[model samples]
Structures are given as structure tokens and as C-alpha cells.
Target: MPALKLLKLPPPVTEEWEWQMNASCRDIDGSLFFHPDNERGEAREGRVAAAKRICEGCPVRRECLRYALESGERYGIWGGTTEEERRATRARRRVR
Candidate 1:
């Protein structure tokens, strides 16, 4: 019988997340970053723009972006970038 191989797992969620403590959006409402159900067009665009504005002054913007890209975060703005922006970045990386 062949021995079963174990899959390598990602690090625990509790690890190296301290940057969140210094984020500019830390004191803001989370709903600002995430849209409500059926939100679309100008409303969603406005919300995303507001979130990115907050991220512009974040002390941990780089770290937040790295985490989002690494974790495949598919919603909300991070590091001043929208979900569409992140998706484009991922696509570019894959092409490289």
C-alpha cells in the first residue's frame, strides 16, 4: 500500500495580523467597505471610492494589500484598491 501524502496548509489566521491594528479604517464603520445587498451602479462605486480614500492614509496599506492578494480576498477595498483592481493585478501576475 502507498503512504498517503499530507497537504501543506497555509499559516493560521491568528499569525502576523498585527498590521490591522494600525489601519486607517480601524475606527470607521465596516459597512463602508462592504456593500449591502442589491447595491449597484453609483451607490456601490461611491462606497468603494470612500473606502479607498481611507486606505490612502493607512499605515499598513502595503501589508493589507499583500494579505488581500495572498488570501484571494474577493470583496471590499484594500490598500486603496477596488476588487476589480485586485482582480486585474492577479490576472497580470498570472500572465507573468
Candidate 2:
């Protein structure tokens, strides 16, 4: 039998995630973007609003949203969007 050949795979692209370095939330507490267990109502909404405020001024906001949407991120606030918001966006995309 002939020698087996190994498939060559390209290295992961780190540059694709470089935008995270410039994200406004980088210096802030991560908890602001992720609700704690048992969190509810106004408290969760307040945290989400605060996180979105930071995202609003982020230079990489669009890139962040694109990444989250493409990666199917299912938790936390990403690119100014809550999990519900991302779900809605995905739903809209499916309908189009």
C-alpha cells in the first residue's frame, strides 16, 4: 500500500479577533456585559443598558456584532445587543 498522506491545515487567523483589543469594554468589568445567575427585571435591563452604552462608543462595535452573529454567541451582551436581540436578528435573517 502507498504511504498515507496527512492533510495540511492552515493556522488560525489571530488578526480576525484583533478588533477586540480596541473594544470599549476591554477595560471595563466583564460582569457588566453578562448577567449573573438569578438576575432579573430592571437590574438586568440596567446592566444591559450600561454595557450597550459602552458599545455605542466602541470603534469596533460593528466588527464585534458581526463576530457575535457569525459565531452564534448565545450568552451575554455583545456589540450593544442582548441575547434576545441577537435572537431576533437571526430570526429576521432567516425570514429574508
Candidate 3:
């Protein structure tokens, strides 16, 4: 009989993720970030503001924003920034 060899995979690289573990918005309603069918005007503003307020005190705000921007998130509030805000940020980054 021939001997069989087993293949092994390397462990994934990890960093300190305690910030995400302690995010303030972790328990909040996700609907607050993605509201009624791309709503606009004062109501949208209020919802975004509410979401941002939660993000403001979040320890993982930077990580969240980096993730959203890198992943090209086209909806909802992340890291205290709205879709339009992220769009502008992307444009600015491109210009630089």
C-alpha cells in the first residue's frame, strides 16, 4: 500500500480586534443606517444624524470607515459618514 500525505493550511494573520469587539453601534438597530428606500430631505438627515451619533462614540469608527470605503459601500451611514460623504471622500482620494 502507498502512504498518503495530508495537506495543512496556514493560520490566518490576526491583529488586535478588541475595538470592533467594543463597538457602540453593535447593538443598535441596523435600519437606522439603511432607511426607507434611499430617502432624502429632512427625514433622511435626521436618520443619518442619529446613526452618526452612535458612530461618534464608537471605538471602531476608523476600522468601520476603512472597511466601508475599501468595500465601496454605496448605502447607509458608516463611521459617522453618509453615502454622499463617502463618495466625496473617494473622489478626494482619487484626486490625491
Candidate 4:
């Protein structure tokens, strides 16, 4: 997986509080930067869920997930999708 370093931008200097559930950004081409898990699937899931709580307060979640899937990222949580889900999707695709 690649690295998405843009997600850590000082909370959007311009947007401030504009980031919502539908917000989207390039986020350094959407890579592994957003990954919070160091290999523990359960721990990562918990972290993603915790992050979702933050997204509930965010305005750019939708866009984030969209960018993630679009960029073929099989990493941390994005657009509400988990690494396992992405892996399953890839596995299914391979089966086809």
C-alpha cells in the first residue's frame, strides 16, 4: 500500500470546520499514511471506529473514502471502509 501524507495537514488551514462527511482531497495520492494499524486487525478496526467518531464531527469523510477507493488503497479506514473490506474486495476481484 502507498502512503497518504496529506491527511495530517494541521486540520485544514482554510476549511477550518468545513470538513464534513462528504469532504474529499488528494491527500498525497491516498496511500498508507492514514493507516493507524501496525498489523493488528482488531486494534486497527477499533482505531478506525474511534476515528469515525471524529469524522462524525468532520465534514470531509465522504470525500476521503472516495479518494481511498479511487486510489486503490488497501490500507487504513477510509470512507468508512476497513482494510479487511478492501482486501476482501480485491480477493473477490481476483476470483473473477
**Candidate 3 error regions (>4 Å):** 1-19
Tell how far residue 84 is off in model 4, in angstroms: 1.8
Across 18-82, the per-residue lDDT of candidate 4 in tens digits comes to 34424443233333336633546776556666655554544667666656666788666666667
Judged by whole-model lDDT over C-alpha atoms, candidate 4 comes out at: 0.58
Each prediction's number of clashing residue pairs: 0, 0, 0, 16
- Compared with the true structure, all predictions reach lDDT values of 0.90, 0.93, 0.86, 0.58
Q: Which candidate is the best by lDDT?
A: 2
- In Å, residue 82's CA in model 4 sits off its true spot by 1.1
C-alpha TM-scores of all predictions: 0.82, 0.87, 0.76, 0.44
Runs of candidate 4 with Cα error greater than 4 angstroms are 1-42, 87-96
Residues 1-96 of candidate 1: C-alpha lDDT, one tens digit per residue: 999999999877765888898999999999998789999999998898888889887899999999999999998888888788999999999999
| Better TM-score candidate (2, 3) | 2
Position 29, candidate 3: lDDT: 79
Candidate 3 clash pair list: none
Position 77, candidate 2: lDDT: 89
The best candidate in terms of TM-score: 2
lDDT winner between candidates 1 and 3: 1
Candidate 1, which segments miss by more than 4 Å at Cα? 1-15
Q: What is the C-alpha RMSD of each candidate to the true structure, in Å?
A: 3.6, 2.8, 4.5, 11.5
